[model samples]
Target: MKKQILTTPDGESYPILTGTGLLETCGQEIAALTAPCRAMIVSDSNVAPLYLEKVVNSLKLAGFEVHTHVVSPGENSKSIAVFGALLESFAEAHLTRTDIAVALGGGVIGDLTGFAAGCYLRGIRFVQIPTTLLSAVDASVGGKTAINLQHGKNLAGMFHQPAAVYCDINTLKSLTPHELADGAAEAIKTGILGDPELFAIYETGDPENDAEEIISRAVAYKSKIVTEDPQEHGVRKLLNLGHTAAHAIELLSNFAISHGHAVAIGTAIVTRAAVKRGIMKNDEGTRIINTLKRNHLPTDSAFTAKELSKIATLDKKAAAKDITVIIPETIGRCRMEKIPISALEGLFADGLGEQV
Candidate 1:
């Protein structure tokens, strides 16, 4: 297993392990961290049948009192109702602050479970066992845990770091091509923010063959950023590179479009506008769009500029009358630009290649 350590500014730290067959030894790893206390494995309907038993058995073998809570899989599960149900499950399980909650699925499972773990008993420890590529490279590392509100996505959440993260690349083999592509969007976004070599991997390398390396690099990059600004008060905002417009697209689609696809569209929009405005070179913009397309990700959305700006202004990143957007100056560099809410529509127009 390839391992990376993420240390926060406050000195709290966790290990992120990525490799094949890590799931089988998950219990042992958790045991090493704590005294084999009670562990609640929170999964989704889709993943429970596939890997829940393995994790449960592993935790049991490691002397942990294991319990399981499975929920329906989807973005819909990331709601207040589901979060309340999960907290109730924690209470019912009698999980103490010392005990850990294990998230055993994709980003939704990780986010919901992490948020629940953070809220239960004033906060208990949690472990992330990400099953999808997107969660492995993105959600599993960041301490940001949130549930979507009726108003927008991730409007309700907190910074609750996990005790450990086990990303078994083997689980990714069970994913469909579309699901795999879903993750590529985040990986590409990471490359855009920083790491030119990682960006090149998507441009010319075989992602499937380089899964371990890709996860390792992406985790390392995010780990560095999170460590620098654990609370997202500073440089950490760079991580929101494509997420501003992406969230708007998701809300507009009523979540018919997946997060990664929305990110692909959002990244393309931002890069297109950056190029047109001379913030980024035309060649770099073309490379980004082409890379997303190469991975079967979308570069455009059906939502009009006016429609996107309306929803985007309501984003959590909005402060007073300004919203901070991460604009790419080049392939491996990005900067935060705070634009007035009124200008957001024109920015979207520029990105959409429409006259503003």
Candidate 2:
């Protein structure tokens, strides 16, 4: 397995290993996290069927008592109702804190399960086996777990770190073109946050063909930031490059647009906005736009400027006096500029690709 040890914000180190056919190793891998006891895996409907049995078989073969709970897949399933059902499943089986919660799906499943584990018994252990590329590269490693609320995506959540995370690249073979595009947008965002050379790699590399190397780089990039600041206090803030506007688009669409695609559009907007703000160069912004388009993600969407502005006001990155904005100076370097709400109008206009 390809391995990297990441130290999250609270100074905790966890392993994120990537490779083909690594799902079978979940037993020996997670056995080191804790004792080989009862591990309750929370998964989604679609993905669980494809690989859940294999994971359970591996654990059971390795002498672990494994319990599995499968819920309907998609962001729509990330709700309080699902959490209640998951907890109910755990309670019915008489699981305890001594046991573990293993999340085995995409971002939705990982976040939902991780949040449940965070609250269960005042914080038990969790091992993330992220199936989707988006989860593998970003969602799984960060420890930012949350289910969506009526108001927004990831608005309801907690800072719950998992015991460890496993990224099985083989599972990604099932992705459709749209799904793969979502993951590519995130990889591009990582570049927008902190690596021009890495960003350049995507410029020439074909997402249709270079899935393995691209996923690895994205995972490695996220690990570097998450290891330093697990919490979004400083360096972690850079990771939010497209997230600010992306979350708005997700909410405005009622989540019709996939998270990664919204993020790709969000990235394009911010890159354009920064250029208009005179901080980011024109060439760099063009690179970001072309990248998004090349990946088959949206470069622009039709959310009114008024609605987006209001959503931005409620973002986690926004506070009483200022809001933190992630702007790329080049490819690998993104810095946070805390600016007043009043100063945002011009940039917003520019971000919409509307010239002053």
Best by lDDT: 1
Model 1 CA deviation exceeding 4 Å by range: none
Task: Report the C-alpha displacement of residue 244, candidate 2, in angstroms.
Answer: 1.2
Question: 207-303, model 1: which lDDT tens digit per residue?
Answer: 9889999999999999999999999988899988888889999999999999999999999999999998999989999999999999999998899
Compute each candidate's TM-score over C-alphas. Answer: 0.99, 0.95
lDDT of 2 by residue, 176-205 (tens): 889888888888898777666557767866
Query: lDDT for each of the candidates?
Result: 0.93, 0.81
- Model 2: lDDT to the true structure: 0.81
The weakest ten consecutive residues by lDDT in model 1 span 347-356
| Position 31, candidate 1: lDDT | 95
